[model samples]
Target: MRNRTKSVLESIVIAAILLVLAQTFLEDFAVLIGWSWNIRKILLFTGFFFDLFFTGEFLARLYTSVYNGRSARYFFAERGWVDLLASIPLLLLSSGPAVLALLTGGAAVFALGGMLNVLKVVKAVRIARILRLLRVLKLFKQIKYTNSIMAQRHVAKITAMTVSLFVMLLFGGSLVVSMLGLPSVDQVIADRHSQTVERIVSEMPAESREARNWLAEMTDSSDLLLVKRDGTTLFSRFDNRYYTELFGPSDYQYIPREGYDFFFDMRTLGAIQSKDNLIFFVIIVVFVLFLLIYYSPHFALTVTDPIQVMRKGIEDDSYNLEVRIPGRYEDDDVYRLADAYNRVFLPMKDRSRGTTEARSSLLDFDDVKGLLDGE
Candidate 1:
């Protein structure tokens, strides 16, 4: 009953972990698909809370293991290292520097010229979330200790392979994406501003006053600074005094412009990233599916089927009979197991049979002596 309760609790933990893992991946995917701000915020907070919870869990397990003098077994055999890595507060860690930079007016981060590059590298730490997949190992362990038909070596191996394949593809694909280098925030902003300027230029009126009126009707008044080709300001919506303070003379200017240059506001860049990252999105879906589908049947045939057959043979009292392994699998571990069992079982069965026959033949001597005495 105690074991059953423990199993039930552990099962609940695994289920919760699956949900958290899903949320973690979804948070990353949301960025590439331009999910809503509210949804992203919810995922972010959920991740933070779960990270804290897992950290506490790791600490509790660590203390318990140490108290029991089984620290090494817990850390190595029980995968404590995986728990430690997966329990890291990824959302908080990634957000820490950005928050500090903002609080310090960017000096805390940008004081050094290469600090921006360092921050970009820090963003990749989110990929460590993949380590959480290793928690599936505990599920296999749980199955082994419980009364489940699926509690077998093959099931454990398959679970390991599935988790390993997923982690490898996700981490490797994410690394590739990072190596290719996604567009920077500044670059995205500049490209959008240029496009908007070109479109507005083609439609603006020749007269400055009419152009100003049209611009006011079409765009945000505070964001545009329309100017003629000859260096004359045409329709300046910027506050002239603060404009000089905020922007340098050549800031946001377009090259070889005929009509005007417009100023655009900085906004969140998720939509642009989503559009540019379609290839990675497709790779994530297609590559994982292809590998899983390709390997499923192979696992069924080579691993699970052999284990099932061996188990059935033992249960049916067929240990003395040779396990009929396939010719091709003669070199495999399963074949060796069957061969070993047959070699030992046949000899033991023959010895037992001989002993039984000798006992039956000799047992009549005592009875014969007693009958002679009675006569």
Candidate 2:
């Protein structure tokens, strides 16, 4: 189980990384190719795949809980609820303010559900399956060879830490993007401003002075300026205040063109670039810390636990086959070692007991012999 969990976690991390990379590169390609809809479809499919995997994982967890005599119904119901809610985007594409309102409301609910799922994953840490690959990889170590029981315990600890670290990094990244980068806020503002300018331009009469004046008003408020087909600045009254504040100077010289053209601050196009690099660094540091925490407990539980159990069992002489190391003893190698020790010790204990009985008998016989001699 520990191995299985580890494999799944690793796969998830890899998939997430791939998804991020794809989004970064493909978006630009789509834009250049004028296939933006195709890009959206690809993103939708990726999301669907993620949803499917999450559902499967949730169900597997639920099954484990059921087998372990815990109530699985609650988890199943909650996961099902999330799936139902997430399915909304699959069907609905209503336009206008209503769609926006629905999406906003759904986003809040989805966030809550996602948080709950995260908590569930954390709670399930105790039962996470150990990764088989990690166990096999550890076999290369010559000096500090762990028994099967200890290996299994370590595997579980590693799996838990991996999942925890991933969750932490994911949330941390989101927090940074939200608070500092403000990508969503920026997007919203940009959308609203663009729509407002488009509307104003559409309402303006062709080649009219009033149209030019309205465009000039918008240019004052925003960095965007309207240009005519004859390479004339429609909004000659435009003050590029925002552009100057953002970028040192306007690099593009606007010649009066034949058709209307829009100009704005180009530097603000990819503002999240720096934030992304910072987030990457932070995630790497957090992951390293997680690894340290994961392996530190192995010294106590992996080495000490089995030895203590063996000592206790040997001293008792009762030979409790049920006596087990306190930590997770699921690793095959550790289990075999424990079995070997038990095999060696149990017979030794029996022989010692028999020898003690024989000695007592000999002492009794000697005492009888002495009595006979005295007679």
Candidate 3:
């Protein structure tokens, strides 16, 4: 995984993710606005390209990671596990059993492919359910769930749907994951401020008039303002923000998490306004988001690639002390790891190479000394 190649692959996958998520979000909006834009067919068609690209990217990194000596533990950690669960099976849909079926022309592959096709049908149903969620939003006129969710009376079904959406679709299929994951907006917020959210929820009362007043303010103005424990201020636009349940439903039907409440706005017009924001604005936003999601995880690749190279080098007995990680790796824990490996193994390798030569030299010296003694 050269830096350049790693970057390109990440860019591709991230770009694909954004495109898919945008399509997903847009489709939701389109349904809300009652537009029949055929976004579904278009999204499905585009999904194939994304799936193929990501599948290749996933396999490449997996091989490189395994090749480099990543332990089962390291590989199964948060980052690796997400890549494996989210990316690999989706990839296998096209490459794994289907391809195997073609190559071997075996009944097992056929059975596997048939089962996968069934899964695909289930996936379509889930997507349809996702689209149906747009309808549920219509129920939130003032502050209520038209339908009971999770059998809880006050819980907005839409709120429940969003939570269920994230979880079910996470495991539902690759397409669902990409469609939901790409926004990466909520994901970033959750990760960056999870502790803050917990703290806020714990400290704040379930019936604080101030919090209730704030929720009213959020609804009246169509935005939620949150100042975190660190005093880092954050806000969510009613249009841009998606809502889900954080806890048992009470005054918090649409609160997505403890840290933030869903800024409810009835108009599904979205953040889009009349001739104000440009196409460039949207692109820049997407690009910035791409940079965030794109770079955060790929930084791990920098650590793993060098390890792989070292693994290959050692296995081949081609000891190269010149195997320096090209960029700034000095402060990285992985860098210290690689340095330590070289220190212990390289010296031993050098000694092994000198072993026979040293024996031969000693024999010559002994022979000379013996001859001199005899004379």
Best by TM-score: 1
User: Which is the winner by lDDT between candidate 1 and candidate 2?
Assistant: 1
Ranking by lDDT: 1, 2, 3
* lDDT (Cα atoms) of all candidates against the true structure: 0.57, 0.44, 0.42
Task: Summarize candidate 3's per-residue lDDT along 68-145 as a digit string, tens digits.
Answer: 777464354313443444344544443333334334644554365376543343333333323222212222211221
Give me the runs in candidate 1 sitting further than 4 Å from their true place: 1-5, 28-35, 89-91, 94-322, 331-351, 354-375
Error of 3 at 240 (Å): 36
The sequence of per-residue lDDT tens digits that candidate 1 reaches over residues 1-375 is 999987796787787676764764576577655555456656656766677777777888899899999999988766676667667544344333434544575565456427545434343544455555555454444443322344344445555556557666876776666667767554556566676677667887877688777777766633345555466666566666655444322123333466444544332343333333334434433543443445444554555655666575455432445566677877888777767756775567557666664233424577789788998
Candidate 1 displacement at residue 310 in angstroms: 7.2
RMSD of each: 12.2, 16.8, 23.5
List candidate 3 stretches off by more than 4 Å: 31-34, 37-39, 71-74, 88-120, 123-375
- Give the lowest summed-lDDT range of ten residues in model 2: 126-135
Error of 2 at 119 (Å): 27
